[model samples]
Target chain A: MNIIESITKSDKNISDYKSNLQKISLDKLRVNPIPSSKNEIWRQTNKSKFYRFLDFKFNNDFYYPQIPGNTKNHNICRIIIGENKKIKFKEKKWEIKELEEKEIYNFLEQKIIQSDTTQNWSNLLNHFLTDRKNIIGLNISGKEIPSLEIICNSMTNFLNSKTLLVNIEEETSVSISQINIGDKNSALSISTYFNIGKESVVNHGIISFGNNKSHIINTLNVRQHKNSEYILGSLQYEYDFARLEININQVEGNAKTNIKGIQITKNNEQISTYANISFNGPNGFLDQLNKSLANDKSHSVFEGLIIVPQIAQKTDASQLSRNLLLSNYAKIDTKPQLEIVADDVKCMHGATISQLNEDEVFYMRSRGLTLEEASKLQLRSYYQEIISFLPISKERWDLLALLLKDK
Target chain B: MERKKEIKQPLLEIRDLFASTENLTILKGVNIKINPGEIHAIMGRNGCGKSTLSKIIAGHPSYEITSGQIELCGKDIEPLEPEERAQSGIFLGFQYPIEIPGVSNLEFLRVATNARRKFQKKEELDTFEFEELVKEKLDIVKMDSAFLSRSINQGFSGGEKKRNEILQMALLEPKIAILDETDSGLDIDALRIVASGIKKIANKNSGIILITHYQRLLDEIKPDFVHVMADGKIIKTGDSNLALELEKNGYDWTDEFINKK
Candidate 1:
């Protein structure tokens, strides 16, 4: 049987509210089956690897996640989403409360379903596969909210699905770090939604990785109000097959959005990222940079789209994609698309794919560094451009060191 | 006749050197010997193989030595890699230093200094110790302490880049230092500063080679021997007067000399 049929057959009894939403999502998937290689959306995707990802059975039993021992930090509020859901801190400036069923239904119908249901296939797929208990929705508020961290892990030999929804009140400011880990032979699907209120600021980071032969499909949808600022830094590596999709909408314009993301692939892995951003009103701004490094016969792909309608006059947007091909067999594909209907808007997009500079490598070698050491130094330099923009602290995670350890 | 005292070993010796890139030969039948405590200046027009000779000595991979022998203190060093040649005390000061972003200058210097120290059987310095040593050496180029924390040569002015190169030379303390057109882009003050730094780093146990096209730099740092090169070979060797003569009359004089040979 197909993945959708299998998921539908395994559906269990739940509240009428959640079951209704799942039914709608299932109908959508049934109408639009998996896209073939001829489809523009899945043209670069490896068909065999995608089929393998969909072959896993849906996991119904709750499996406890393996949390690393070294992930404790007193300065931030931590939340773990797994078999044992837990929240670690309480502060007076901010609060978190679960979303009611009526609230979830209202959000889906208004924001997601009405926006463009056809384009959000990944979110619909997640909604259809995810159990009612696996969804985590929180309403957060306050001006001085503490930094937040969310840790999500997948179980082995199963297709685990989870969803997160966060609603921020007006004038609230928060920094969030989301970490996702995939276990061996596992498949994970995650859908996240964020609503930024007027005059609010959001700093978000997503760091995800997987073990041997693991797969992940992550989708993020964000809505921003006027005068709001949203900055996102994302990184994905070490997954056998991974896809990240991002959708951002400036609701009333006059908002600022900045995104910096990187994907690293090695050893036959395939990773891809697709980002679509729209400026709905006037004076909206966006600066996006996407980078990928492919090594050891791996493949990396990036597709970015920016839309500026007639109402979004005076909008400013720029998108840049930089790729590094580290081996002769490694492959990188990048496409930047801009659709600007506004006559007075300034929009620019560019893409570049290149190898390391030989002159730079030889310069270091003449300074007493071995060839391997020189290459590693150059790689470190390349990784720093994106790493320095991350909100995490080096003393806490030391991501640069982690990236260079194997090299 | 009284027996002649044994001659001291030359610090660097190049004999019958012939080198080329993929389709063109750049250096042809060149010979030079540099002794301890002596400074040699090679003056030539553009593309006369001055910089190519310096790069060949440092083991640049672009050029192949068709028939040549490079000896360091009487030991053949033609087979050593660039880093090994550096660890064996050969330094090349580039005319245009590359700008490397995101790599700390101090960290690079520490690693390079320690690499040479390890080859010389000396214990490597930790971060703290290396910082102290580097600060002491910074005075040789009169560079500010702020540049140490920045990326190597990224956004540095031309003079600052040259000074940084000299600071590296001081830290590495190579036996044979080849400064290739170090005064090309410098103003009078920067040239004076760079020349002073080079003079300070020169010692009795080390030799210096300056490749240039003008006599202004030679005025600051005097050379014991000045060699005029044309068509990939040294056509004339004389005292410091040759540099003054070339400065007065352009490279046109070298054509007559080459034709006579």
Candidate 2:
């Protein structure tokens, strides 16, 4: 099936509710099932939002974004591309290509690999499983570069592809940051995949900005080997309905994973993120910190769970979700869960949701600071907590700080 | 805006000022006034409106002014926000100062001083100049210069924090200074240092309104006038000798003396 025919079929055959033993791809639609009135997740969350997103359509065309310019002098490479699908990254090569026919069919055939929750498995596959045909493999073997920068161009037209692969060399290391930028007001859909090698380290950062009235759904699938380290960082701004789906598979023991995410939304925007980390190997460690800021009637939802299998012992993992509600109407749904089958495992989870500090506000204002000045100062201080964790040079840090000034 | 038209009225005027927090009316139609070139001592009982009055004049949102007016230099300042009133030259030396973590004292002082300077459209001190200015002010407060490197009021002792609060007031140079129980948590030595610092920094251009529950501070920092506050109102005003009389006789001293006068 082609892209248009496939999308048309997906738009047609999607049922309100699935009855019997649902197909793996169809399980993605398990988001809002019937007796939905009794859904616990929807008790505090507005259930109508799922239906509102059903009417969103994708825009067709590819607009590769240019790197944000730095007014200050810096030594970083500039990866600039035009308003076309063609992208040229001079830093390093980690490009996505069309997947083989067999590879595409195999992934689509087994779209649903069941374990614990089938909440998003069926629907995601039923709609997205078939059309995936893109493949990006990581080749960090022979030649080494300073850094591996993957500049992904935006989609003017919606296309569903599958099986993007990344293979890192054994004992080799590289850092990749995909800067996603598009028009200020548009809808977008994208998928990404990663495959790690043994004894290698991977540093990946996904930064995206979607305009108002826009929607983004990104999926990341990773497979880690023994002694490999993976750090996944994501930052999103704007985007009315922004969603990120992260699936981490620890295929080997002694591997480590760290996932850090930060999102800032305004203007009645809604963002829901679902991330899952599974352990297939023992002695694995996972650390994650997710923070969201909601202002101007915006809403943010962070639903994440860490699953440790019975055999996956000696695993040390933690997840934290923090949110700041900037306005009275702004809302946050932050829940972090730890599901461990092993009794001896070391795992913990916690979350915090709050507004700006009143005493701090008063302290700042008492010093002749205005409300806006005080709030900005507090915001800068708040972001500093995470910015301190970023592994960028002072120059890059300053540049990012200036970009987030108005933010 | 600061540095605007000359304001030559009494530095502060609290006229029939009735204030409350929650349902408790702390200031029941109290009135007091102070002009430049003079220090006024307001000695009151523990539950009197001394601190509440200080917070009200500072425009603390928690305190409500039911039916009264407070004017600064003849202009009604009751309508302004706390920060606006602060920028308009009103300072409150809190007895129980707050410790705000993460904000360095230097950064806080610079931001505060620059805010006032911004309001006044006066030349602001650059980094180098600000360091010198802060150093001088720290000495004026008799505080160690290392305090500037610490967070605002964080981990500071009672005396150090109070001295820092006074340091901020001196740096801001508000027209009216209300020291609310400032000497409550200080030792004899700390009190002497703090009282002398206040006396040294406050010029005749600024009116010092000192509120204390004890007459000890009044003795150390001699005032031109002493007012005895009772039931949220000042019922007696006399020369500095009134503080000595009240010190020797307690509340009944002012009560009997006022009843006779």
Candidate 3:
């Protein structure tokens, strides 16, 4: 109770934006863990030990994660030593800054926040506004962002307090890979707002492997102009628990979005992901796949919802989650749901959980491999399912491979 | 730490072995014996219990050995698990090798070698030493080093997958190797390399049980003992000439021999 209320306490002046956030207290919502006999999300969730643990809203102090045994080789962002620590970006035409409250309000008034309801999770995000005005935002539209690298270097109090937002202008194509690193047990509530112009494309890459209890809640609000495209790659491998909520809406016809993500969980760690995509126009498409491997007592959860409105004709959406449970006790909860009111829309979803085949093991042993070796071999193959589909980068693939598998 | 037992005893012995699946018998009252420094070939048409007999010896759980006595090096081994028998040097080259999509070939090799080595109370190889050890075995199957990093058979061709089986055989160096139809789908190049690799590893301290449907592989490995099997039992036993005759006259000769009996 102390952990989570502390999160909501960061906000004080909520009456100003009460109209934006639904007229319901998030803490008081009748979601899971509440004293309700019926639970929607837990209908299929194996909630024996997790029911009690899920109520843990937010704790003020989570022990600083032991610097991961070896991260000397992880391929994340780099940190510079000086004061004007020049931030590096894979894409140009963007600038970073810790703006004052006035600057933040000015940007908001200019329609820089493209998201509608996805960014409304915090009833009062401005309440915890310390570096609330800090972020790298794009100015001009119709320009292409090669591959932006947003560098986040923290001081001692990095997560004790701070928040930031990244906004992309309309009609611009920007690609960014944010690297978050430093000492504090940082809890970052990140929100992204992207606007798509006619026939424009935006590809965003996220490679997070830093060692810290990073509480990152990402909200992506996208508007698809006619014939526009949006592609996103989400990469996460290290954390006690990383929760990412992605919300997308296709506003016009002939637009599409392809989203792919890979996550690796080990130890007694946990990872939670929520993706809600809706098509509001005709002739829009969504193709998404998310893969994860949870070993030891590590737990993984993925909930994907692809909604096609009644007027959203000719929409195509497909989603799949493939999980490999390395240990008998390790658990993966995957739910791919399609809520469609349009008869002409094509939407499908599936989830599968299986252990390595016994016949395959014997076949490997026949080649002189021991049972343990056979298991390792099968595990390597499981992780390769995602790495093989990665966008052709040898260094990233090698680094991810090492982080994914211990042996 | 590599213990060497006495070589005078039978390397493998299966007596009155009746193996089954779902309580129905597939290997009925079969008996076979193989000693060190010898090569035995089992010839039969499809569905003759050739693969079943090999799986039974390797401890495949699906095929239950209802009533039998199997001895390896003069000790009863029917009760041991598949992994236990592997440590004791019983290898089964499968007809269709399974693809393990997540494991790298090199990691698989090191784990297997170390498991057997651990059984023999030997030290396991470190990464550097393991790399060197794997380099030599790469030549055994004429495979490239690039395969070491790739996932095991995730996207390998049929031929490459089979060659991988041979590569593993050369690396582990088991004492009793059972090649179960290793030549079933290989072209001439793969078949020649696989046959040569098996022959090179066949020394006086080891033995091989070559199970095949045709005499094509017999021409390469040159088996010393040829046994014809039908209806889950070996009907006749002879020298290498039996394989040539069976290749020419086919299984009809076996029917004539059975009628004469």
Candidate 4:
């Protein structure tokens, strides 16, 4: 059966509130066809690869999520999605509680129904496929919160779906690391939402990778209030097909958003990122940098958009997309765009695609480094800019070593 | 009784070297020879193929050798890759050292030093040992330790970059060191420090080639032979007096000398 048919026919034991939303999403998916290359957003996407993502059977069997090894020593508050139905952590400084039904309903009404209109396909698909057991919603509040690590995994030959919602209270500061791992020939669909309260700080990192020929579609939505700050660093690699969609809104302006993300693609893998940020009030600020590295016959894509309306008079935003084409056959598509109706706003966008500098390689080679060593050094240098921005500790995960191992 | 004569093989030798790039001849029938303990200064005008010759010796891939032979310690190195040539004891300090962002200068130095050591079959130094060794070499250039922590040449000034080049030379200790325009961007104080560093690094088992246009550098680091190159060929060979004459007359004198040849 097709993916949509299978999801609709599956036994979905969820609350009435989520069931109603799922029915709406299922009807929407039934009417509208799957997006193809003719669509502007999916223009660079390979349709057959995406069809393959939808070809897997819905996984019903229980499987344990394999947590990364190094998280044990860090005293981090860990949550493994698909392993638990309800999670709660309370400490002296902060508390994490599963969101009540009313809170989820309010989130759907306020954020999802309002801002996410045109590009709601991924969210709709995720909502349709994710049952109550697969959804994790948390309301986090405190001044000195412990670091949080959330992990999501897909089983082999199965299509898994998961959703996460986090609401940070006012004056709270928190750091969260989200890791998504896909098994061989598996597919995963994930939807993540963050609501930052007034005067709060959120440092979030998303590190996602997959085994051979795995696929993933991830969507992230964030809403920031006044005097709040939201910083996101993401890295994705080693998937046959993976796409990340990020939507951030500065609700009342006077907030800060900093995003740095990179996607590395090798062999026949394809990875893409689409980020959109909008300012609703004045004095909103955004600094976004997206990078991609493509090797072998792989493809990488990046598209970033920043919007400043008339009310956002003092909004300042900059978006840059930098890409590295590591092989002659490799390909990269990058576009950084800005839409500003505010007369007094400052907005800039730029994109660059280049190969490793030959002169730099020759310089290293002249210093007794072999060509392979020199290229690896260059790759390490290229990956360092984004890797260093990640919120995770280097000791906890040797990201650079992992990135350079195959190269 | 006739005394026994001692003979030494040349550390570097280039015979009838003809090289080109993209159908343009850069080095045409060029030749130079250097023995141990000798410092050869090649002075020429801009675009006289001075830098081209240095790049060719370092085995830059852009240039194709139509015909020639480059020997390191009497062994032909023409077929070696750039790294292979470097491993075989040849070092070429760049004219404008490439700046690599996000690469630590200390780590780059350590890797390069270890590569040379591995080629020489010497034990590789661990991080602590390498740091100690690098600290000693940093003193030669009078550089601060902070530069080591930064990206390779990334925010370094011109003089610092040149000193970094020299620091690399000091660490690698190649048999033949070809420094191209190492004095171009240095102030007088930096020049004194760098020239003295070169002098310290020079030993009886190695040869140095200083490519420059100024007689000022030649003043600080005396050369055994001064060659004037014009149109890809060394037209005149003399001692320190030749540099003084070049300084006095500029490269205009070399035009007449070339005509005489």
Return the top candidate by DockQ.
4
Q: Rank the candidates by TM-score, best first.
A: 4, 1, 2, 3
Candidate 2 per-residue C-alpha lDDT over B74-151 given as tens digits, one digit per residue, 9 for 90 to 100? 899988888888888888888788787656788778888877877778888887898888888888778888899877
- Residue B189 lDDT, candidate 4, scale 0-100: 97
User: How do the residues A1-407 of candidate 4 rate in per-residue lDDT, one tens digit apiece?
Assistant: 46845544534532433566566566566545365466557888877888899888876355777765475578688888777756888989889899998778667545444433347678878876777677788999997777898988899989998889999999999999999998888999999999999999999999997889999999999999999999999999889999999999999999999999999999999999999899999999999999999999999999888989899999989999999888999989998899889999889999999988999999999999999998888888888888888888887887888889877
Greater lDDT among 3 and 4 belongs to 4
TM-scores of all candidate predictions against the true structure: 0.95, 0.77, 0.71, 0.96
- Indicate whether candidate 2 or candidate 3 has the larger TM-score: 2
- How do the candidates rank by lDDT, highest first? 4, 1, 2, 3
Tens-digit per-residue lDDT, A81-193, candidate 3: 11233443443554333334455456544332332222343212322222222333433244543344444433333332223344444556655555444333444434455
Complex DockQ, candidate 3: 0.39
- Across residues A208-313, which tens digit of lDDT does each residue of candidate 1 receive? 8688988998999999999999999998988999999999999899999999999999999999999999999999999999999999999999989999999999
Q: Which ten residues in a row have the lowest lDDT in candidate 4 chain A?
A: A8-17
Q: lDDT of each prediction vs. the true structure?
A: 0.86, 0.69, 0.66, 0.88
Compared with the true structure, what per-residue lDDT tens digits does model 2 show for residues A1-407? Answer: 23223334443465522322123444434332222435433344444544333333432333445455342565433332222233233335333233444654454345444422334432353234323212333345422444444444444333222233455657757676665554544444455556687887888877766654555656677889899899987877767666777888898668999888888888877777777898887999999999898998888989888999888899999999989988899989887888888777899899999888877787677668787777776776666555544444545545246535766
Residue B126 Cα positional deviation in candidate 1, in Å, after optimal superposition: 1.9
Docking class of 2: acceptable
- Candidate 2 displacement at residue A405 in angstroms: 5.4
Model 2 local distance difference test score: 0.69
Lowest summed lDDT window (length 10), candidate 2 chain A: A80-89
